[model samples]
Each structure stands twice: as C-alpha cells, then as structure tokens.
Target: MPTTAFSAHYSRELDVEQLGWLLSGDRPGDDQATVADLSQWAGWIRTDIRCSSCGKTGAQVVRPSKARGSQAVLRQAHFRFVDHQGGDGHHPFCEFYGNDTGEARQTDSLLNFGSEKSAETRAVRLLVCKGIETGLFNQATIRAMRQWFFDMKSESRFKVRATPEALAWARSLQRHPSYRRWTFHPAQAEMPAFDWQAAAKFQFTEENLALVELAKTVVHQDAEWKRAGLMAAKHFGQEVFNTAALQPYYEDTLTLCAFVAKNSGISFGKTSPDYYRFQGAPIPLLALCALMLFTSEWEMNTAIAKFARLLASAEPSDLSLGNMIGLNPFHDYAAWRLVILAAEVAERSLKGFDYQAQLTAIESDLRRQHAIWKSAG
Candidate 1:
C-alpha cells in the first residue's frame, strides 16, 4: 500500500533505504547507523508531528490561512516554513508541525540576582521529534513528516530545482567548522540532494518542548528568563549586525538562550560573575549565554555598557564581535540598548554603580525603544 500519507508533490517516490539516508544522513555515518531501522524512525517522526500539509492535524499544524503574525525570530530565513505553505504568498508543499521539547528550567541566587511576551519561537523539527512516541509513529511517517521542513525558509536563494543552491548554501556555512565537517554533506553525497526540497531542519529536547507549552499557557510563565532571551535577540538584531543581514545566527541562539535560562534551575547552578567573564572572552551567542545573570535591571545595564566597550575595542572576528554587526533590527536595537544601559548602570556606582537603578533604567528604556520601533512605521 502507498500508505496514508498527509501530502506529496515529489517528482519521484523515495524508497525506505533512500529515505533512511535522507533521515539521518546529515551526520556522516549516521545514515549507515539508520540504514537498518530508518523506516522505523521515519515513521515515528511522520505520524507524530502535526500534519499541516493537507489538513489541520498532527503535532502543531494550523491552517495557513488561519496562521498569522511574522516569524520574527528567524532572521534570515523564509516565512513559508512556519506559517502554512501559502501564508505569505508561498506554496504549500512541506507540511510539518512542531511542539515543545521538555528540558529543565533555572537556578536561584543569594537572595539576590533578578529578573515578558513569552512567545514560542517555533522550531518544528524539534517539536515533532520530541512529540513522537517511541513505539507509535513509523519511519515512513518521519520522512514524510520532515517534508514540512521544505516549507521552511530555504537556506539560500530560491530556484525551482534548489538542490545545487541548497548545497552551495550548506557549503558556504564553512565558517561553522562543526556542521561543515560532520552534519551537512552526508545527506547530499549519499541520498541525493533535493530528492525532496532542500528542507532545513531543527530539533530540541523534550524539556524545551514543555517550556514552549508553558509559554503558550500563560504570558507570565518565566518572566526574567524570557526577557533575557528577548534582550539577547534584540542584541543580535540591532548592534552586532556583522553582515548586511542579521540572518544566520539569531534563531538558534534565541532558542538556546531561552532554553538555558529556563532550564538552569536543575540543569546548572546559578550563573556567577565568572560565567559572565568566561563568555565575554568569546562571541557566538555571548549575549544569550549571558542571559543567566541579567536577573535584575542593574546587571543588564552593566552588561550592556561593558558590551559596548567590547564592540568598540575587541577584535571584530571574536564570535561576539561578529554578532555586533550581523543584521536584524530587533537584535541590533537590543544590543545597542544594552551598550547604552550598561554604560548608564556603570555610572551609578560608588565606584559609579547602582544595581537597583540599573534594572529600572533598562526596563524603562526597553519600553521606550519598543514603542519607538512600533511607531516608526
């Protein structure tokens, strides 16, 4: 039987082994690892995720027409992935759905430290994978489920036959040595690129999955943690615009930031000053990783001010340095705001610092900036 799949527009059909390579091939020998049981994995992924391609069903599928709002978090990516196929005049081919990945949530402090649209930044792949039951969904379904990824913002420019473009995009990410060597090429060399559209995939743990659920349940789920994440994204969108576009690094960082803050409770202990210094020395999501300390307004201002100097003086390629010039308005503004805030907070110290005042100033400024941006239109 052809199976009761949700949707398809394949120029061709893929067999089980081919599909296995498609599923785990991104990880060098991972494809070989799955060759024997890939169908089982694919099935699990497919049947478990929300089947958004055809109907309003599965893990997180909602009608395209019914879907609204901008996928603001995903900086350089396309919109078609999250909102249905035709949400913003895009086609409806990939019909994947996502949910929460349940991970841990925060560390407390010495009667000190501190801390809201707590929205769920959708990472459909992780969502579906986390939601999948170990024994229920099948491998075929998993492969089919991933079809939803095609709908996501393509990694590079769009063309009807995107295989080459996608491969090029993957190769261009050569700066990220981790994925370049191990995670991206296997699928293409072995399974064939674009056998399915060059769909970009994302995943998360079950704990993260639950946190997302919590965010949706109440606007006040994890106040300080969520705020920290927003600050980090804003930091990326605004000042650290390394390239003309604040594309590549924002989404993942946001997820990671939010994940770390909320989960630090059981996962790691309270973040200390040492942690901040350790991060200051590197870039890549430094702002987000720093999310642990901004419990109060004062820490935020000091952090931002310190960051500005880092931007002004540090070697630009320092991962954090590159982020200073990335792209994305939200990211830029926050980063800039922090620089300013950090400076102002430092001024409050007997040494020229006031912890309490720092937090207050930041909140006030965040509100003002947010309003300005909203009205700039």
Candidate 2:
C-alpha cells in the first residue's frame, strides 16, 4: 500500500462511477477538471480517484469513522494507494509513502507535507517600524480611529465634538504609559508627525494583548521558498490567511486604505464614471494615496486636505486592486494585508457612513473646480 499526497486542485468529489469515466481507457469528450466544478466538493467526502502525481489508479478515499455524542470528528477527502493485482504500477518513489528510506530526506518531507507546515516555520518577515509589535492595535481600535477620521473629514463645521465612545477609547489609550509620551490631538488642524523613534520603542504591556506575536527570527529562507516553488502548484494547499495576524503589523493603515477605497467609489473592476469618476486612470494610485495620507503622519485636517487635493489632481489608470495584487511592490504580504483591512473598512463604511453626503460634496467640489478653470481661461 502506498500513500498519496492530497491535491486541492481537484476540487470536485468524484463518486466511483464518475471517476471511472475520467480514468476510463476510452477518451471522454470536452470536460476537463476545473476548480469551480470541484468547489462544491470542498467539504464532501470523495472516493475512487487516480493520483496524478504517482500514476496510482483506484486510490480509495480514506476517512475516519464518525464520532459519537456531541463530539463530532471532521472527515476529509483523501487517498491511500492500493495496488490491485492487475492495476497499473504505482510510482516506485511516492513522496507520500510512510516508509523511512534511511536517507537525509528533509527536502522530500517538506515537498510532501508543505501545506501542513506550521506558521511558526513559514511566518513572513515584515519591515514593521521598530516600536510596533503584534497586538499594538486591534480591530476595535481601527474601526473607532477610521470612524473618527471619517467624521472629521465629512463634517463641514469646526470642532465637531467626539462621541463619548470615541473620546473614551482615545482617553484610555492616552492613559497608557507607553503612549503617554506621544501626542494625540485629533482636534489639531495638522496631522501629528509619526515619531519613528517613539514608535520603535513600544513594548507590550499587561493591559494590551496581541493575537499573533512577531516571530523571533526568520526560519524558512527565500532559498527554501524557491526550492519549494518548484513543486507543482497543487501541493501548496490553500493559503491560510489570518487577517488578525496582520493587524499588529498594519495598525491604522489598513482601515484608512479601506475608507479611501469605499468613499472614493474605487473598487476592483474595469473603470467607469459611475464606479470610479476617472474612467481611464489608475484607481490603485488613489488607494495608494489613501494609505499614504495616514502614512504621512499628518493630523486629521491635513490628511483630509491632502485627500481632497488628490481627488482634484489624480488621474486614473487601467490598473485596479486586483491588478496591483499581481504586480511588484504591491504584491506580497502588504497586498493581502490591505485586502483584509480594506474589506473590513468597506464593510463598516457601508453600514454607518453617509455616502450620499460624500457624493454631494464631491459633485460640489467638481463644480467649484470647473468654475475655477473657466475663470482662469
């Protein structure tokens, strides 16, 4: 008996009969395996499939017996290679086989169980500003921060008072000794400049708890990743993304990106005036602006003013968020991290935001710009 490495690529769970048609000697017409077709098979138990890697035919889907009482065991679709007397020969060097070959097989083990690799080993190295560690800010903090900023930007009048909830959270944070040295005056006309030195010195206090702590050292090297990359894409398994893990790394930057994307009416799709005002320009550049406004360490008024300036001058490109995720600089952990943050921002913005008011403001601003241009002419 040989064991086969499970591949997530075959998303469809094939019954004995359907699988027979696929593995049949007679060529079948027009239907190739697709992720969409197999997507429904995600939680279903599959059986009687062939292993594409080992050329092992009639591999039975293995699952454990159902549990009793309130304790339910999750059953997964997998395969164990069994050779019937007349069946096709199994690959002599099946990676999934349990036998110890008595050789230095670190490479083989990693290749076989790559997806099962723990985050401790696979944790991505990030260039977080020195003071920040994991759990510095949580989702609740981000929502309040973004909402406060949004209110500051949207309200027309001077010094609109903060809600008790907003003021309370802010006051509580300031009382913490780690943040006491840093000035946080949201009412100030200018954004507080980021003090990288102060930011760099932050250490965890008993009051604040982080979800995912920063890794001690880099374990899986890029060289190891390059080697692992050579394996077929199917073995990589589904990327287990924990957005909470990114919260400590990103802080408020994530929420800000989301606010810009949602309020600016920029999303991932082909450009149009209805969805994105600039029909042919780079949408991501505006998103980049949103992230940068917060990054610039400016206060509420200055950050809002900077974004207004961007809307007036920035041009659209053929690029989108989906497009940016595939390109360099934007690609990698930052893009995924932003995806989580942006989604969270967008969701919150939809429920509580005054989109109609924002739209009216934009239209009025556009009219003002037109008048200015005409006067100049």
| Top of the candidates by TM-score | 2
Worst-scoring 10-residue span by lDDT in model 1? 109-118
Model 2 C-alpha lDDT per residue in residues 28-100, reported as the tens digit of each score: 3323211123333423322334443343454544432234563332321224455556333345323333322
Point to the candidate with the largest lDDT.
2
TM-score against truth, every candidate: 0.17, 0.19
The C-alpha stretches of model 1 lying farther than 4 A from their native spots are: 1-55, 58-91, 95-157, 160-377
> What lDDT would each prediction earn against the true structure?
0.26, 0.30
lDDT of 2 at 102: 22
lDDT by residue for model 1 over 247-363, one digit each (tens)?
A: 223333344444444533322234432342222111213332332122122254443443333324422221100011010112222222223332222232232222234334544
